[model samples]
Target chain A: MLKIEGLRAGYGAAEVLRGVSLSAEPGEITVLMGRNGAGKTTLMKAIMGLVKTSGRIELDGTDLAALPPHQVPRQGVGYVPQGRRLFAELSVAENLEMGLGAGPAQGRAATREEMLELFPRLRERLHQRAGTLSGGEQQMLATARALCLKPKLLLLDEPTEGLQPSMIGAIRQVMVTMRDRGLAVLLVEQRIEAVLELADRVSVIEMGRNAEDFSRAALSGAEGRLRARLGV
Target chain B: MDFGPYLMLAMLEGAVLAAVLALMASGLSLVFGVMRVVNVAHGEFYMLGAVVAWAVTTLLGAGPVLNFVAALIVAPLVVGAMAAAADMVILKRLNYDPERTIVATIGLLYILQQLTLMTYGADARPVVAPFNERIALPWVEWGDKGLSFYFPWGLSTTSYKLFVIAAAVVLIAALKLFMAKTRAGLIMRATQGDREMATAFGVPVERVYALVFGGGAALAALAGVLIVPIQQAHYLMGGDALLLSFIVVIIGGLGSLSGTIVAAILIGLSDGIISVFFTPTLAKMIATLAVALVLVFRPQGLFGGTSR
Candidate 1:
């Protein structure tokens, strides 16, 4: 489980996250939805210690906000950053090996074999450079790389952004599978249908602050109001 | 003198010079490649290596072979530790900002140079070679009798010079293997590829940077130790080594290991042969001209990948 309270973060004097509070629990996906520049990505980065912040961010009772970015992964937070940020020059296997360098997870991390089975396409291109992979394949590699950490909480920033419909479906299924396997996921997404289907809890962010929080059960009757609030 | 034997002798001498240059330049390249900081103080590290070697040899006062062996091992370690300390105490504090680190290293260059001048003094000191057996070089000529072999007078090299060449070759091969095969190499390459990604994956990139800086200095120091017997140790010696290293790195393409080696050989051979045939100044002038041409035509140098 992860908890963040009154998280205010930004670059220089321009603050993007203004006293936002949120939490994510195990065996569920917490989806953060907002328009462009709503600070969804900034929130994720704040949790990962990538940006300067004044907040109480705790993962399983450890103060994550006090740690440096490199120490965050060791605290059981696996991040799939915006743009997939794969080690372009490194081979697929090597990228996976780098994921292992994050130190050991609390329980055993996912093995190379399990990762290959989850993304069979990666098995065929183990020696190929990750940059040369197709967009869909690169997305798979990014997600698989994060999974390789066997993280207690996985933070993904737009895993389906710019992905094809088929690839989107594949990623959707992967998220569902992870949720069912008792892994906690904090996802920043734009797709309404995927959010409705996958998100156990939805938090709408507006202008760097949490505007509304609702469970999936509350979504059916308030679809129009939710869409209006999201400006979609 | 028969030109054939003389040419052979020139090439042999060139190989030894090339070997030492390659070691020093490769270290310079590695530091630039990984840290993206131009280490202006690199030459000072080389000078320090020689100084340490001299001090160690003097203190031990052993026979030539034992003294040289001890100095060779001890000098690099000491210089490497010093470099690591500098990285942590100074470079890290500067946050490795490109311009700031450049200025910082310039300050470091002076600090190191002056410190050595004060402690080691300004005198040029020699390190006796482990062995100095003279080997006569033979050449075969097609005389009237056909294929007559003769030992050309004044065409020979010291056994120590040949040993220097062999040692350089072995060390280079080991460096290549270490970069290609080790986990530490993997971490270093990852950091080089993307610093942010390496950190996000828990690589402890600052630590890697320190190690790389130290490693580069160690390499330069090793070259200093090997060549001290041929070229005496002095506080001022680093100036020429620094200039020559920059030339090698620039001509070979900055940050390319193979390029550094190739450029070192090219420049080293020309310097050796030209110095023997004409004047050392002429050889240096030609080299400078060649660099200017490369800069105008191929700014990336001979083997640099991408314009960076």
Candidate 2:
């Protein structure tokens, strides 16, 4: 489980996340909703310690605010940053190997082997350069790299953004499998139907503040009004 | 001299010189390839290598072979460390601007050159060839034109220049293997190609960048050391070679091994051949002008990727 209290963070001279607070319990797909420039990414960056922040960010009751962005992976928070920023010059195999870092992970290379089963296409393209991959394949590689770490909390920044319908379904299945395995997922996304149907609980973020918290049932009849406000 | 024998001798010497030039040029080009830094200080590194080799050998009372061997180890590590430090303090702050970076490194090059001169006292030192024996071929006749080829048959190549030539070729091949096969090497490739994305993936890019700078410096230094036996290790030894290396790198395409090697061989042979007919200065000028013309037509050098 990941929790934040009054998390305020921003770039120099521009504050994005102003006093935002939220929590996602185990096995919960908590989708944080907002329009463009809604501090969604800022929140994600703050959580990963990529951006400097003031306020408490705790993962399973341990303070994570002081850690570096790279250290967050060790703290069980695997962030798939926006734009699927993969190591372009490296082959797919090298990218996965780098994710493992400083040798094999926890005496088990099994995590990677398992992922190859879930995403067989990656196994086929292991020797191919990562940058040459399609958008969806690159996204899968990025997500799979994080999943390779076996993190407790997965912070996904728009996994479905710019993805084809088939790719979306594949990613959705990946999320479903993660949730079924009791993972805490902090999904920052724009898609209404997919996120609403997939997320166990929803938290709407309007201009850096938590506007609404709802269950899947609360999405009924209010979809149009929410869609209009969000311009989704 | 008969044209046939004269031409054959020129070709052999040119090949040996080409090997050394290729080694020096690869160091310069590889640094640019990985870090995109001009590394104007590269020449300083080469001078330092020769100086270090001379001093270490003298102080240790070692033989020329040991002196050459000592230089092989010391130059890269010392210069590499200095390069790493420079990157951390100077380049780290400089916003990755090509123009600024070039000026900054040119400044660095002078500082290093002056530092060494102050430490070592501006003098040229000679490094002796390791062995005494010269195994000579009795005679090699090419169509009865009387072309005699001589070398130490037991050892690979008796001439230190020829030895460096062999090492240079091997080093390049090894580097290609490292870049293509290794995981960490792949990270460097990515960093060089798309710096922003490499950082996003949590690559220790800054550290890698410094390491590469130092690695290049070290290689240049090695070249200086290798050249010591052929020429003297002077305060300005790196000056001429550095200019030639830059031309070779430009002609080779920055950061490309294949491009650099082919171009170096071409330039080295051209220089030697031209030297037979003209002064060294004119040979250099012609080589530079030749490279300039190549750039005018193919800005990326002979083999550089067209897009760059």
Candidate 3:
């Protein structure tokens, strides 16, 4: 489980996240929806210690706020940043190896065979440069790489952005599989339908603060109100 | 005097020079490629290597072979430690900003140069070679009865010079293998490819940067140690080494390993051959002119990809 309270973060002289608090539990997907520039990315980044922040970010009761970005992964937090951010020149296998370099959780990481089985297309392009992958394949590779950490809590920032419908479905299945496997997922997404289908709970972010929190079952009747709040 | 023998001798000498240049320039390129920071103080590390070698040899009071062997192992380690400390103390504090690092290294260059001068003095010092046996070189000539091998007078090289070339080749190969096959190298390459992603993956990038800075300094020091026997250790020696390394790096492509080696060979061979046949100044002039033309026409360099 991951918890954050009174999290305030921003770049120099300009605060983007103001007193936001949220929690994500195991075996569930916590979908965070927000309008453009509502600070969804900054929230994820702050949790990963990529940005300076004042807050109590706890993963299984250990503080992550004081740690550096590199140390955050060691706390069982795997981040799939926006844009995939794959090592463009590195091979897919090498990229997976890089994920392992972060010191996998419990000295255990997903093996190449496991990753290949999960994303069969990756096995065929094992030696191909990650940059050369198609948009869909790159997204899959990014998820596979994060999975290599065998992380307790995975943070995904818009994993389906710019993806085709088939690729979106594939990603949806991956998220569902992770959730069922008892992994905690904190996902920042814009796809309301996918969120309704996949998320166990939803939190809407409004202008750097948590606006609402409700069960995914409540989303069906509350779609219009949620859309009005999201301004989507 | 037959010109063929002289040309052959020039080429042998050029190869030796090329070996040393390749080691030095490759280190420079690797550091730039990984850190994206131009190390103006790199030459000072080379100078320190020679100084350390001199001190080690003198303190051990051993035979030429033993002394050289000890110095070879000790000099790079000491310089590498010093560089790592410098990286942590200064470069890291500056956050490795490109312009700030450049300025920091420039300051470090003078500081190191002055420290060496104050401690070691300004005198040029010689380090005796481990072995200096003369090997007569034979050349094949077409005679009345097919081809015959003959040793032309004065056409010979010292065993130590050949050893320097061999050592360089072996060490360079080892470095390449280490970079390609080692886990540390994988982390370094990952960091080079994408710093943010590497950090997110828990690479401890600061440690990698320190290792790389130290490794690059160690390489330059190793080259200095190997060449100190031929070229006396001097306080001002790093100036030319730095200039020549920059030339090779620029010509080969700023961050390319293979490009650095190729450019080093090209420049080193030309420097040696032209110096033998013509003048060293002319060789240098021609090299400078060539670099200018390369910059004007193909600024990315001969082997460089699109500028990083």
Candidate 4:
């Protein structure tokens, strides 16, 4: 489980996330929806400890905000940032190797083989540089790298932004599998279709604050409310 | 004397220069590649290696072979540890900001040089090579006696000089293996690719930075130890070494190890061959001009592609 309360964070002096609060429980996909510049990415960065935060960021019972950025991932958290920030110079297999170091000691081989199965394209290009991959392939590599962490909490930021439909469907299936396996999936997405398909719970943000929340039962009739709140 | 023997001699000298220069410049390139800081005190580290070698050889009072071997092992280790400490204490404090670190290293340069002067003195000192047996080289010519091979009068090289070239090749091959095969080397490459992302992935980036700084210093120190037998240790020798390394790094492309090696060879051979034909001054001028041309046309460097 991951919980953030009144989190205030941003680059030096200019706060982008102004008192935003959200929670993501295990075995659920909680999608964060917001317009551009509404601090969705800022909130994610704050969670990752990439930016300084003043409020509480707790993973399970542990205070995540108190830990350094490098230590945060060791607490069973996986992150795929806005850009597919793969180590450009490293080969595809090497990128996955990095994620393995942060993951559980048990099932190390199984985890690597499983990720390769999930993205067969990566297997074909195991020795190729990550930077040379196509946009869709790069996105697959990024998601696979994060999944290699085998985390209890996964944070993905705009993963489907530039991906093809088939790739997006593949990503949606993986998210569902992870959720079924009792992992908390906190996603930031712009596509309503994707949000509707993957979100078990939706949290909307406006001007860096929580605007509304809808459970899966309420989401069916909340489409108009969500569109109006998101202004999309 | 025939031009053939002279050219061969010049080539031999150039290989020695290139070998040492490659070791030193590779250190500079690694630091710049990973930490993104220009270490102006890199040459001082080289000087430290030579001075430390001298000190160790003198203290041990062993045979030439034993003393040289001991110095080879001791100098790099000592210099590497000192550099790692400096990285943590000084460069880390500056947050590795480019301009600030350059200035900080400049301060380090003077401090190292002055300290050596105060202790080691201003006089240049030579460390004896393990062995200096000279073997005359053969030259072939189509003279009155068709295709005759003769030993040229002055065409010879010492056994230790040959050892230096072999050592550099072995060291470079080892470095490549360490980088391409080991886990720690992978971590360093990860940090080099993206610092923030490496941190996000649970890499201890600060520690990696310190290790890289130390490793780079060790390489420079090793080069110093190798060259001390041929070029006497002097406090000011670092100035010219630093200049030549900067030229090689720029021409080879910043942060590219292969490029650095290629550029070192190009510059080193030109320096030797050109000096044989023209004045040493002219050779230096030509090298400097080459740098100017590289900067103007291929600003990204000869082997470099899109900027990082």
lDDT values, one for every candidate: 0.89, 0.79, 0.89, 0.91
Candidate number with greatest TM-score: 4
Better model by lDDT, 1 or 2?
1
TM-score: the better of candidates 2 and 3: 3
Model 1 steric clash pairs: none
**Residue pairs that clash (backbone atoms under 3 angstroms), model 4:** none
lDDT of 2 by residue, A1-232 (tens): 6889999998887888889999998888998888999889889878877677999999987888976554666767677878887777678877777666622357447877987888888999999989899999998998887787677888899988899999999988998899889999889878788766887888888888887777868777668866876886
Question: Compared with the real two-chain complex, what DockQ does model 1 have?
Answer: 0.75
Poorest lDDT segment (10 consecutive residues) of candidate 2 chain A = A99-108
Predicted candidate 3 versus true structure: per-residue lDDT over B201-233, tens digit per residue: 888888999989999999999999998999989
Candidate 3 regions exceeding 4 Å error are: A103-110, B143-145
**Cα lDDT tens digits for candidate 4, A61-89:** 89999998899989988999898899999
Model 3 lDDT tens row, A58-128: 99989999887788998878888899999887899888887776654454444656878999999999999
Candidate number with greatest lDDT: 4
Best by DockQ: 4
| Superposed Cα deviation of residue A55, candidate 2 (Å) | 4.1
| Poorest stretch of ten by lDDT in candidate 4 chain A | A189-198
**Where does model 2 sit among the CAPRI classes?**
acceptable
